[model samples]
Target: MSFARNFIGLGGLLSLAAQAQGAYTIQDTYDATNFFDGFEFFNYPDPTLGFVQYVDAVTANATGLAGYANDGIYLGVDYETQNPAAGRASVRLVSKQSYTRGLIITDIAHMPAPVCGSWPAFWTVGPNWPHSGEIDIIEGVNLQDSTSVTLHTASGCSFSQDSWSPQDCGTPGDGSQGCGASTDNTQTFGAGFNEIGGGVYALQWTSDALRVFFFPRGSVPADIDAGNPDPSTWGNPTASFSGGNCDIDSNFANHQIIFDTTFCGVWAGRVFGDDPTCAAKATSCEEYVGNNPADFQDVYWLVNYVKVFGEDGGFKRSIAKPFNA
Candidate 1:
């Protein structure tokens, strides 16, 4: 991959943090030499211990699926729980903080998306109910052509269709549980995102609004190119998940990052089965994997890395390893 250099001033940094950061320059590249000397996977204060479980029985006992270069963790899904025709694969992560400024960028390098029944997602959630909040930056089920983004906040936070996209996107209520409940049409997000090498879904947050951006592999912004936290250069972007409309930011403080692969259960399983159009093509969850068993060999997400970046003016930025020095 070729590299480039970009400049990010204070305004550009704040804009990119709220919108899309600048293109990734070579300086942001992730080198194996500088792994996790200073970084720590966030462990949220919420009661839940964040982890990725497999639908297959055998692998689930192994804890996290696999690690690429020992950087980010992998998550697998079982055959029995997977409904391929439904086009839903399960993945979830919970933040460690109650309410601090943070960003999660996942390098989803090698993953299985070409097959059927692959539903992958990158998102966040709060401690309590809808009052806390849930942000789904990339979510799609059952043969979807594009990806979808949503925010689930109580009455406090909501979203608005900025000048970027003319669509009348509504800020979902707490009951819908944000994107978890909002059944958005999958085909609208474009074909590139659902394809191979997948893409990067960034969930940027603060006490204000939560925004999301999806970057295909080669096109990941320059600010994140070096693979550390630098939310200064990304440019103005059309796709975003703002929490300002509904008061969504207050419920979450210390957020944890979760990466898991789940099979058919509630969303991808039951919901697709009920859809009139997709039901005809949907087969029994059993027929999908035979006994690959959630206990054994299942689907997994091979992540390149999981990075955390702070917002424009909220928290202090700390670096574990200096790529340039």
Candidate 2:
């Protein structure tokens, strides 16, 4: 309960048109006063089949599961039960509005611990999914050393990055292991991320490629902290996905931001037994996660704010009392 809350209704719209000039203007800001106003809770079943009980915003707020925490937006889960039938209680959120091409940056204060059976992600996806494209800005499964930036697209899409693997951004079920890259910086995600008080994760979507950048808490760029992000001056990106044979524009459109944490899903569950440390915990991913509720107390996201910049940005018109007169 050490957080602030505001009941102010959502107001205004900001121009977020993309420009080729590389200069971006402030389009929108989702901070403590308006974080929940900007994004909506996703109570739908887990698409990745993770052991999770996604709850509505009403339930979230009422149950102390999602709310403000220490000046940041905190999304947490249930850790008191010893194997509930409905799965671990958690929260999933998606932006109310969608975007096509632009700069999305978020300042996070804490992320879920990189413990066994835990999967957390902050990403964006096109309205049509694979047909449009999916960008994994911050994502990793169970005990991963670091998060990975991946781009999943329809058939015939791939990128050129030094450390990326498989070189195939194919659609789902193509036997291709996704096209993405990861860094050795453990501080970029999980336990290491929370140690330094989290950091900033930014994604730039353009007609040619989708790129991701990470700036640890103290190393954040002056331009970004100033609300004027210039990726050009931010140096080389952490990961960049430029399509070789794919039409980036036609393949990706109207993307909505997302944040979620699931347990023992497709990735985490499938590889559970393969990990020596995790495997030693239990016979299966479900067994470990279901029995150990106390281990997940640190499973949460505390975000300071999320900002969007565009070629020509302007603030949304604020309204008061609905002006029925």
Candidate 3:
């Protein structure tokens, strides 16, 4: 059902799976020239839409997305004095409609989780938050090496993770209402998140479950290319999201993927200097600052591409290759 074409061990491999029902193809590929068009805005500071600013920072597009080095879109944030909340920023896509059932796939070059006050995430939220469940597919805190996937709901919702690594923790509300942590190698998720090519993240949502999966650079199949994709064959959805947990499926309509690098504040900031664990490091949260101010204008996130696929009735989503080919 799939094949690979090796070109001097340099070019990426390609894999194709025979369609179980209808034809499948690539729906959209966010390249450098067109990547900015799909996103409404980047790195703008506004709390209403969840944007935070710092004094020192740097952000730019990396080349991995464009198949060239340092040429794709990237957003980096570095703060020296710490802000209200981690110097956070976010953007929205599909503002009018909520996509309850679809496949959201992206080639992310990096989602940094490097410092004590660093909180990096790729997640989705409904029109209004809290009431409409929030699905955090990839998230991590300071010193966390593995990514944490959690859902925030009002009630009548429970989650179970069937991952290769031992899953841990469960609390409720705003992530502080007794939430727990999963026992996975947090660094495995961050170690090479940006350096060794980056990783591919896929979030599949259906009436029955919300699933997530991560594919490392060399491990991804060739057929999952921007030119063509077959969701059924990209490996199981990373996480199986369920609907029995408070109509979360309905709450996540018209959601968007967000990439943010927030600094010490509220959640992560509180842990600094006060938390015994942090004090033991002999490095106060302030020690992380290395001449760079809160808004240094040097940090950023590089995204390869973001692709969305609307399910066509069954367990499959068919994407047609654009004629631009």
Candidate 4:
């Protein structure tokens, strides 16, 4: 049930129709001044049980873990103290609003560098875990130089590979493994991403499919710069998840955007034995993260802005909801 035969290039006429209909409209804008207003800190225990202490807004700002910096919102982690009682202090933010479908654009100036024992992500998830769905937009663990874009759902969803990479979003053997694709662009993730001053990541989610595109700093589309982004002109996406095997509308709904940096969690810790460079630093991922605070100095996120646009003026303002953090 590969989607290769059904795949539609982003630059094709279908996208042109979306633009011609002027279906997209600015729905929300999150930036330094208003970012905190629209997002809440999650201080609860990590769902993945990462070795991290999710701090509150007060603790985050007081400890310099989260604040405004370089004309953008800065979310960072503790890198000075070693072996904290609970774990290394960090910040995890979730958007107050939830949406079913839209265009999400995030302009980032910097991301956590590809350091050992760190797992950072910019993602969205619906309620009830895999039953609803999860989209990993920008994610990597422990020294990964490229991003892994993935989708986690209950079952049935499958995808085909684009021309850029080999990893395909085929149906998972077990629902827990999910489906994913990897990017080969050196500057699309990790230390190289920060070295080039970061860039924009655009995610377009619709009933038909979920597509993600990445543009380095110098190559960002002019429409994006002018605040009139049109996916029709964006060409092929870095990754696309779609086909007859899945019902996107049924698997995903009311998703909230999120950003966080955790230390030695399931993904990073489980894979530590495979990376020689990291293995030499400590016997285990948790041990290294607990002992080597200095190594995580670059664990932070500098976000320029996050804009959400909805189709046909269907966007709605979300009411504040209590979240465990």
Choose the strongest candidate by lDDT.
4
Structure candidate 2, residue pairs in collision: 12-316, 13-316
Q: Which of the two, 1 or 4, has more TM-score? A: 4
Candidate 2, lDDT over the whole model: 0.78
Whose lDDT is higher: candidate 2's or candidate 4's? 4
TM-score ranking from best candidate downward: 4, 2, 3, 1
lDDT agreement of model 4 with the native: 0.80
Q: lDDT values of the candidates?
A: 0.42, 0.78, 0.49, 0.80
TM-score of each: 0.59, 0.88, 0.66, 0.88
- Across 202-268, the per-residue lDDT of candidate 3 in tens digits comes to 8777776677777877777676663455667776554564423335454445455555555554555
- Clash numbers, per candidate: 62, 2, 55, 3
Q: Tell me the spans in candidate 1 whose CA falls farther than 4 Å from its real position.
A: 1-64, 67-72, 79-99, 111-118, 163-174, 177-196, 227-232, 242-245, 274-278, 281-298, 316-325
Distance from true location, Cα of 76 in model 1, Å: 1.9
lDDT of 1: 0.42
**Higher-TM-score candidate of 1 and 2:** 2
At residue 317, candidate 3 shows an lDDT of: 26
Candidate 2 lowest-lDDT run of ten = 316-325
**Residue-wise C-alpha lDDT for candidate 2, range 1-325, written one tens digit per residue:** 1235432333324333433434776666787777777677888778888888998888888777788767678888888889978889999888766777878999999888877899999987765457767888998988997888877777777665444555667734542256778799898999899888889999887777677899998999998887778998988888877636768887777777788899998888999888999999999998998999999988888888888776554212222111110
Tell me the tens digit of each residue's lDDT in model 1 across 1-325. Answer: 1112121110111111323333321112221222222222322221221112322222332333322233334444433534344323233333322234566666664343423334555555454545555555656554455555655555554455342222212333434534322324332232443344555666666555555655666777765665444544555433554433444436554433444444444455545565454455446433443333443242445556555555445643322221110
Model 4, runs deviating above 4 Å: 1-21, 160-175, 313-317
What TM-score quantifies how close candidate 4 is to the native fold?
0.88
